[model samples]
Target: MARATMDVMSSAPGDQAETPTTSASEREPTPAELAAQQGVPARGASHYAKGTSANMMRSMLVIVGIGLALFLVTARPNSVTPESVDVASAAQYRGGQAGQPFAYAEGLPDGWVATSVRYARSKGDVMVWNAGYTTPDAQYVSVQQAVDPGQDWVDTQTNQGRVIGRIETDDGTRWVQRDREGKVQRSLVHVPDDRTELTTLVTGTGSWEQLEEFAEHLTPAKVTKAGSSPSVSTSPAS
Candidate 1:
């Protein structure tokens, strides 16, 4: 029998004049049946699904991040910044004393020093003698501090530090300094027995080639013994 001439059936319809329609019971399925009927959704319904997938994912990530952050915050117990050191100039900070402290070198441009602070580091041979120079304008810091704000070499490097490569001038003198973010300003000195060394870390701003001219002037000196004091001066810059 042809389908056009028979009653509705899963298979081909047999020869019958009547076509069957689904009953209300069949049309309105049970909850399980309805669920099954909607199981593998149609492509159209899938797009409009009310799901919180994105929000759930974001929440999961935030939880995980909070867990990790908590661990990090609790693991160590110290300030990230360096300690406030007393100014210890080379002349004032002596190696031998009742309670000896570390000594640091202080370099100031002429007419830059308001008063020389003679103090000792609580720790090493390194001395830090801060020159109490007034800020030119209403500024509360040195021009260098305004221009280049660095607590020290390690602080600068450890913090938002920059790497300025070797810059050698035309003359024999070279200037090594920690740049402002990555610009040049100060002179860093390293000394050996027979020679003096200079290192300039310019952060990401400078290229090795850009500092090459300044690097040519530096003469690397080996580390000298602690007892002897060497003169700190600039040679003829290259």
Candidate 2:
């Protein structure tokens, strides 16, 4: 009986020593716990951050596009009018200085704005009077009065256009219409009277009808003589 008891005690001790036991800290961690320990963001948080960045970029692009559109709309060429210049005074003053009858535009309706005026000598030493205007429809037209201009001067002023046809105005003067293909239009007239030796040219990108209208408004201008308070005469071209 003592030997059986000793064997039982020895077996019980051996079983206790051989059996394995696990603690909470020694077990393998779950996926979620591993991710947390590795500092990985959650799926929901990652998606939210990406969505916010994309939305911000889209909003910035939309704002920039809207600003560009507004700028283009406000800066259109047709919406702006050029500053108006005084043709009558310039014609009178230049005519007085040059001792000639300079022509000026008169009785024009609203929206006809004179843009430029100058009196200068050409390449052939010919004195010329120039005036430019913008029509109501935003078309450009200019008048050049030169004393005995040569063919080269005419070609230069008319942009090397060829004579298309002739047109007679209310007065006895006749004008030739010249055009360059896809370029400019010109109306040219010669005043070879005993008193005046002038060649008048109307040129621009405007239509023929608009050019004719501008030519009809040209009026002969008289100037005050140098050092004399002489009176000037004004006449209509119609």
Candidate 3:
């Protein structure tokens, strides 16, 4: 009771905070603070009361701000988003190379290699294009084509409208499924280059959360200038 009231009072604006109660002697405490007073004998209640009141007010403001920020982000999320580390378009990505451009990010070990991929929009709801290479073994085009099948496989696949992107590489499919335990899963993987793939299966998915997660891990190969190639970055632990 006191904790909830304290939360309400703290969340109220400055005017309300200062709007002294009808009986000015009444006060409430945080959930934790209220719990501590049941049996323990301590210093003056006034000692922490004022400080805690201030802290509560500060916390209220922080929480309100965070709520507003979350609302804004959730309400207006990006329609088409790309990741920073392994983006298909950004030239800064420094993975993948000549016949081995795709990097697999999943339940793999340290020995699992990663190459960059480049994706381009070629005039459809989903487009896949090339960026360049991070290694000499990276495939330049296969990585991008597998993820988005644009116009090719659209005619053959079922529920054609449900599919997205292009699939130019090996035998890869992006579809919805359920595990043996009856959990929901949405997955997509493409290895146009190396032909090996990685996937993400969201446990409980509703919106494009699964697709968003898949895009988050799908990286593109990095590209250098027309004449020069990108230098490899070494890991400290390696």
Candidate 4:
């Protein structure tokens, strides 16, 4: 009975040791244990994730700031209407000396605004004195004097407008009227009787009567000494 008891004690200790080894093999390792096995710190991965999140947030904020700045710049106010301009003063300033042989409008209707003036050479090196205006009714009108421009220049100025009729002014000055169908403008061209190197062209959206009225006011001054052409000056007219 003593020998059987000793054998039973030895076997019981061996069974208990084997049971613990089986349990340890079946159990899964924790994340910390797995990281330790791979020689990496578990807390390092968490810190890296937090840093990535912070970087993403900073990028988003930068994009939003740029969008806000663009919105503020685009929403700023701007002026739309053109300002008033003086034609005669601008013409004189642009090489239209008194007593010079240059074409100018003498008596425009009240409230008519001159918007721009230019003294330059056109095609064929013909010097041109031009002025743009806005009528009281908000229509466009322009007076151009081409020095010795031929029929081609007239065609170019009128945009190849068809010859409609003639306008006889009060001063016995005859103007050839041209109409451009399917276009926004018409023109009145006057070539002096003496075939002088000066052709006056008034063209725009104004009616024939308005254009004739404008043409009647044209008075070409005789310049003793034609000065050098001046640079173009443009301004908005309302």
- My TM-score estimates for the predictions, one after another, are 0.25, 0.66, 0.20, 0.57
lDDT of 1 by residue, 112-160 (tens): 2232233233123333222222222211121111112223543443233
Local accuracy of candidate 4 as per-residue lDDT tens digits, 128-234? 77877767787888888865688888998898999989978899878899998899789999897666556788999988888888888876554433354443356
lDDT of 3 by residue, 85-201 (tens): 333323333323222333333332232233343333433453333322222221111123334353344322222223344322222444442222243322233323322432222
TM-score of decoy 2? 0.66
Candidates sorted by TM-score, descending order? 2, 4, 1, 3
Relative to the true structure, how large is the alpha-carbon lDDT of every model? 0.35, 0.75, 0.37, 0.72
Greater-lDDT candidate between 1 and 4? 4
TM-score of 4: 0.57
- Reference-based TM-score, model 1: 0.25
lDDT of each residue in 1-238, candidate 2, tens digit only: 8666555556454365332346789999877778899998434554535668788888789999999999999889757777677677778777878877788678887988888887877768888888888888887788888777777888887878888888877776678888876765655655465425678888887789888887888897777665454333322211
Candidate that beats the other on TM-score, 1 or 2, i.e. the better one: 2
- Point out the worst 10-residue segment of candidate 1 by lDDT: 138-147
Candidate with the greatest TM-score versus the true structure: 2
Q: Model 1: runs farther than 4 Å from truth?
A: 1-111, 122-127, 135-160, 165-173, 180-238
lDDT (0-100) at residue 190 of candidate 4? Answer: 86
Structural RMSD, model 2: 17.2
The per-candidate count of clashes, in order, stands at 30, 0, 38, 4
